[model samples]
Target: MVFSLFSFEKIQKQNTTNIPVSVIICAKNEAENIKENLPLVLEQNYPQFEVVLINDASSDDTLEVFESFSEKNKTIKIVDVKNNEAFWGNKKYALTLGIKAASHEHLLFTDADCKPKSSLWIQKMSQHFSSQKSLILGYGAYKKKKNSFLNLLIRFETFLTALQYFSYAKAGSPYMGVGRNLAYTKTLFYEANGFIEHMKVRSGDDDLFVNQVGSKKNISASVYPQSFTVSEPETTFKNWINQKRRHISTAKYYKKSHQYALGLFFTVNVLFYILAILLLSILFQWMYVLGIIGIKYVIQTIVYYNAAKKLKEKDTIYALPILEVSLILSQLVIVFSNMISKPTHWK
Candidate 1:
């Protein structure tokens, strides 16, 4: 787990060639967000790129916002998606429509609520793409709140997720990528059949698709600080848990190997804490147990410190122990809750 930190290094060779890119955004009832963030996206510092906006059957004024933006910006193209009886509430269907409408082969994806951390977001992400590499994974972070514990939890989870996925991508078996700052090729999407296998499974448009199509040779991990997208974190724990339920529910569908790998890693961490507690209470080799635990924390803290610096979540390193324990307990609740009932809404 610690060795994966090496993968966080910036890409050494950037693709300088002007790659005409298509930025695909699928939004539902995001008029307010669009009004604030779309302008920054349109003003990106790139040679040639078009923003493809998909207003997915929003009841609000999302379509009006897209049209308003299109009128002023010639580079903006809109794809208004009607609700499909068969694929209702499924984001993949809306995203597929947006992908089809994209004018360029190189596709970059972000949510309507997200904005690039830097104008070079597209350049940094797209630079990793080449003839062999079809998929590019970039970090998507949440906005921090000064005194919000929920905000800390959200950002820590996002940081840890990026660390694992980036490491796995660097190792060759890429299991997932976040949608807020992911890129791929149009031909690659078509070749993979464009989410046809999991259209009904609402939340895996980004991670699940990458899990199906990602390979060691065809994928690249982009970690430059400029290659990030930031979005407002869920303000309430209830809303965040609901969102997490939808996201975590998709893991059961990953390939068997990935399922085993992720499951084993999580199991080992949980058992380590459980066994340590039991041993310390019984006074069974307590000294050795403490020594080993101390060593583990030292190493983990060092690695997390470096990773936090690279990922720009440095505040999280201070409360790593508390955050890890809280995250694990909450995830256990979510997993059991999901087993009892699946998340209803995808958005």
Candidate 2:
């Protein structure tokens, strides 16, 4: 987290740049979201870009919404996908068709339920691409709701996850990137054979693809708020936990080095709290334990404060300690729950 705070840099948007990009959005029953959010995508300030809307066998009016937009906007291209028995509930197959339909080499991806924080999102994300760098990782934030504990918890977890991935990418060990605001070239997607390696796993259309193709030299982290995408947080605890279960189940497919690094960090934090609580209950080495815990909190607060400001989630700073503890406990429950039963399909 500290490393990301100091090392993360924003890419300057170029004037008179002509890199054509295809903004791909795959929706499964996202009619309401597409109606509300797709205009912002269609109205982006980039010079050359097309919007590829993939109606992934949506049962709702999602395809109708796409047609409504495509009728008026010439740049909007719609691909209607049917349910194939071979890849019935697989998001990967839908995304592959969308990628193939994209008219440009550079592609930016976001969820149907997400909207860019700034119109310069395309310019900001695509600016980092060069001869060496193909993957651009942007932070995905959750919308804040007043007087909602779950909303705050969701935002804090998103903030911390960004800190870890951004810090790791900055430290030359790129691990994962969120699809809510991630971008890459069409050439790289095909070169890596896309998501074929993990197509059966419904949840990793974003991170697992990054884990397979991301390298120290080819991936860049974008910390600018102009590049951010915001999505609605799950409204209920049960829904959020199920959503997390699907995501956490993908961790096992990550490279071994990343598994160890991420696992060690999580294990150390979980143990830190466990040991602190045990020692406090027993009143064993009371003063020393309190001092160490105090020091850790102080450092964590400082790091999280700076990171929150950069990511535009500073509202979460006041409840950092509480949110961290709650998130840790929730993640433990999610891991155990996934072990007992596999996570559900992507949708």
Candidate 3:
């Protein structure tokens, strides 16, 4: 086993690592957020990086806002589209332009509305980029203290989302990622034809892209706190619902294999619980439902609670129950809306 041991050590040392990264933000009419969060981007403590913002023809002062910062900071470059580039109106089109302008080989993406929660966000993320995988997943959370039950619900949704991808990537089956805090190499983008197939859709530039690059070995995640992308949660339920519905519109295009995996997981678990509850009176069988919920939720939370502590949001656990309940309910609504009409535009 001496030779075998030497080869194993060689393979272990070959794990993914840090490389220069260009964080790309696509903005449209985000003057307020651009001003508030851009400094956070410019102030990252990392040694080597650049910030490229694609001003997707915002009607607001977004271009002027970024112009001031770009003047002082050489790393920040703003690409302005005349609001007439696509004329069809899609965020992915703006993102594609941003990718072309990026100076580095690795692209880290977030929205103008998002701010990195930690200075080490880049370092934590870059550690996961390797030749084995072209993509790395990062977490994005709702901004702090944004609401009551609604805010908690939003955070919980984010938490469980973190759990699903982070855990599943470790276990081998990768699903999707939140665009607000994700990274991939420039080479990977071009190799995948860089979102050309899904360009027409308003959403899924992130999800669809991940679907295309899905692989248990190649896909990876950084669940640590410093790498998390934190942004304002939707202030109103109507607004949040609208944003979610737009996101739901992209689900129709997910790969059939990914769709089957998700459907089986969710349908099987949900159906078992519903059946147990129906037989609760005669069999007390629903007691088993509580056990399954407790175990899965706890194990999931424990993993993420460690992540939250790292990210400095230990208090997020308080929102857990509300988030889970709302997630189950809202998904049904999203599924129904998906059937009616394909949603477009962000309200």
Candidate closest to the true structure, highest lDDT:
1
Q: Best-fitting candidate, measured by TM-score?
A: 1
Q: Candidate 2: where is the Cα deviation over 4 Å?
A: 1-16
In order, what lDDT does every prediction score?
A: 0.89, 0.88, 0.75
Clashing pairs in 3: 143-231, 225-311
TM of each candidate vs. truth: 0.96, 0.95, 0.85
Decoy 2 TM-score against native? 0.95
Off by over 4 Å in 1: 2-13
Estimate, for each residue in 54-117, the C-alpha lDDT of model 1 and write its tens digit: 9999999999999999999999999999998998888899999999999999999999989999
Query: Tens digits of per-residue lDDT for model 2 on 1-347?
Result: 53543333544454435599999999999999999999999889989999999999999999999999899999998999999999987889999999999999999999999999999899888888888889989999999999999999999888888888888887788789898989999999999998999888878999999999988889887777888999999999999999989888899999999999889988998999999899999986799889989999888787777777888888898987799899999999998999899888665
RMSD of each: 1.5, 1.8, 5.6
Candidate 1 local Cα displacement, residue 32, angstroms = 0.2
Ranking by TM-score: 1, 2, 3
lDDT of 1 at 54: 94
